[model samples]
Target: MKVLPRQRKAVLINSVLGVAVLAGAGGAYSAVTSHSDSSARADARTVTVAKGTVLATVSGSGSLSSPSDAGVNFTTGGKLTQVNVKPGDKVSRGQLLGKVDATAAKETLAQDEASLTAAQANLTKVQEGQPSTSTGSGSGSGGSSSRGSANTAPTPTPSPTVDPAQLAQAEAQLTQAQNAVDAAQRAVDGTTLRAPVAGTVASVSAKTGDTVSGTGGNSTAGGSGGGSASGSNSGSTSSGSSSALSGFVVLTNPSGMQVTANFSEADALKLKPGQAATVTLNAESGTVLNAKVLSVSSLPVSSGSGSGGGGGGGNSSGSAVQYAATLTITSPTSNLRTGLSASIQVVTGEASGALSVPTAAVSGTGANRTVTVVNDDGTTQRTPVTVGLEGDSADQILSGLSEGAKVQLASVSASGNGGFPSGAFPGGLGGGAGRTRGGGAGGAGGGFRTGGGGGGRG
Candidate 1:
């Protein structure tokens, strides 16, 4: 067979063109298939919806301290003579905590007694009548006898007694002496500082042999009266001074432990008397103390009042606003001490067996709450849900969506909706849809109730 060169060239060109066209078609098909696969993978997201419990809690910081902290100070301004109790010593009520120097006090007391006795004696003598001293010449006696003989009884003459002015002066001296004695007795009492109530000894300020003057730097004796006695004379001082001063010793009762927590205005509203609380010391880990809300102040404490400024407001520029909540520990452990830092969590409200979902599932605009429930065919439908107590991890679904309803976890993408596609598989919507089976059991809702059957699953 004889073929022309031109014809053979034409045949070769056609064959090359056919091969190129086939290659292009195959590439186009591969690209389409890859795009579909990627879209399917993007649409499906793994989510979990289940029946579980959720708790609502409020957190706050506070300090662990004894409610009754007694600040004991010395009545007199003397050198602290003796501190009988140490910081940790447990003392009984009326125990002898310490004693101030009684040297001046005893001396003063003795002088007061002597003055009182002298005053009493002087008063008695004045009342009885002054002694009469008679010094007369013999002529007066003879003349009196002749006159008496001539007539009836001679004109009776009143006995010359002590001067009334002298009597009054003696009485005044007696009163002064009595007052001195009383003042001395009081000074003696001020020397021994006793415990006013039963409790532990938190601190001791003074030691023995120290000069303790009454409250104001005045001498104990001087405190009693207006008279200023230069030397140590008990009777020289007046009576009213010592009674005005305070006791030398201070005793505190440490059994009643309390925690002061500052809550913001928002948190303060939720708190009420008798609410349960748990306290944990920052110093002691793993130790939880129980307490109850004793009181909540209607008005916030002034900025500088609390231990570290009002309720953790140290860094605040202006006056920090906070209300003081007093919490009394139901039981105090030895580890719990005054001034220890603590954190508290008060359970404002709690709901057990609540129908809850991952916080991510819920979305909406404004106050409206809604969740996207995936149907059996991989399609997602938005459903309105009534939200209840919400916690850190989950939210309580009060109504709308049931327990077993499938919900899309992540958002749908533009190319392929982020949720499961409709009818992708023969069975119901897969992926997160499977997780929505178990809804919480049903029971009376609201108001902390224990042991109620959980809400039912869808």
Candidate 2:
């Protein structure tokens, strides 16, 4: 029982060392628990419902063209004597675009006039019953007696009789001559090329002294869709050049500018005439035009380049089906041209000052939509909701949710486990926690859009 001072000191040192070891272990355990909790919370994102504007739109890429585009050319083949217009020049209907040499046309017309005059005289003489004047020898026996009896009576001269067949033949010849003269006059007039409509000259294929083959018969009145708006006429030529132009001249009416775009079959179903649209030009990135849906093609245009799937007969060739839609630019610009690349956004549905939530927070279809509501006590409850105007980033909440209600984004599973991991979640799909810009569920700022487009700030 007799303990030494050194022995007590050693015992006390051992006790302190053991206590220190336990304290260190406890601290490490606490740190690990805290990290695990934080990681779990990071996978969950919460947002508040608010009143905002939500828009549903269908988008597609296309090109600008004018419905009032036309191609002009000479009707009669000859050397071009004049070219009065160039690309970008404003012209009116009947404005002289160019002229071919009319010398040969005039000469032909003169010859026709001479033939017509001779035919007319011959017809008049025939109608008047004019007879040929000829000398005749008298018969010997009776003639001598008659000649001696000249004092008795003068032989009565008979009036010439018109031949019915001769008159008909002469009249027909006159008619033929008249027709020739009229045709000659038309040929002379055809030497001049004129604008078929009021428009800006888009291209010129010929110039003074250029020999044109007279493509007048194929000239168009510059109607929409039928013109060179497809850039088929974008090729050009200069004055006196020997190369073939799309036509003698190409013209387009800027006032009649429109855009043609292709949309997926799903998006196409939502498109209708008179739907408002926004058009952005690829050439001028900053420029946007106000437009409306002019028409949506009822038939689908099949393409072999699409990823094989869906209603377009996408078989093994990777083909896709798309429908063509036309939009008329209400706010047109003077510089609009055919073949300008454009992006179109047509507003199919819109809701203003409506209660809304992020698209990611809502799940299920139509009447079965549901959201997870986060209570003040940190518990979540499944709440059914009515959705209207489903947009890209946000959806309009019609009922079962109110402004300022906190809601948790629904969890999407991958690998059959309840967890958020890479490669399992596609951005903009249900419940991978990330903040989106533009009409986001958080009601940050910008107009909310939905429908057949990807999600981001826009």
Model 1 C-alpha RMSD to native: 16.9
Cα lDDT, model 1, residue 127: 70
Angstrom error of the Cα, residue 19, model 1: value is 36
lDDT of 2 by residue, 1-458 (tens): 97669989899999999999888866755554455445555567799999989988878888877656666566677898888999879998778887889999999999999999999999889888965564444445544554555455434555667999999999999999999998788778878877766787867866788787754333333312212211211212221111212467776666667888999777888999999999999889899999999999999876656432111111234345789998889994687766788999999898999999988798777699999899999888989999888876789998999889999874423112223222122121222223332212221111122111222222
Q: Model 2 TM-score? A: 0.63
> In candidate 2, which residue pairs clash?
67-224, 69-222, 70-222, 391-450, 392-449, 392-450
Scored by lDDT, the top model is 2
Runs with alpha carbons beyond 4 Å of true place in candidate 1: 1-53, 77-82, 102-189, 197-199, 213-254, 301-320, 365-367, 410-458
Output the TM-score of candidate 1.
0.52
The segments of candidate 2 whose C-alpha lies over 4 angstroms from its true place after superposition are: 1-43, 86-89, 110-182, 199-202, 220-245, 308-317, 411-416, 420-458
Measured against the true structure, the TM-scores of the candidates, in listed sequence, are 0.52, 0.63
Q: How many clashing pairs per prediction, in order?
A: 40, 6
Query: Tell me, what's the RMSD of every candidate?
Result: 16.9, 13.1
Candidate 1 local Cα displacement, residue 157, angstroms: 29
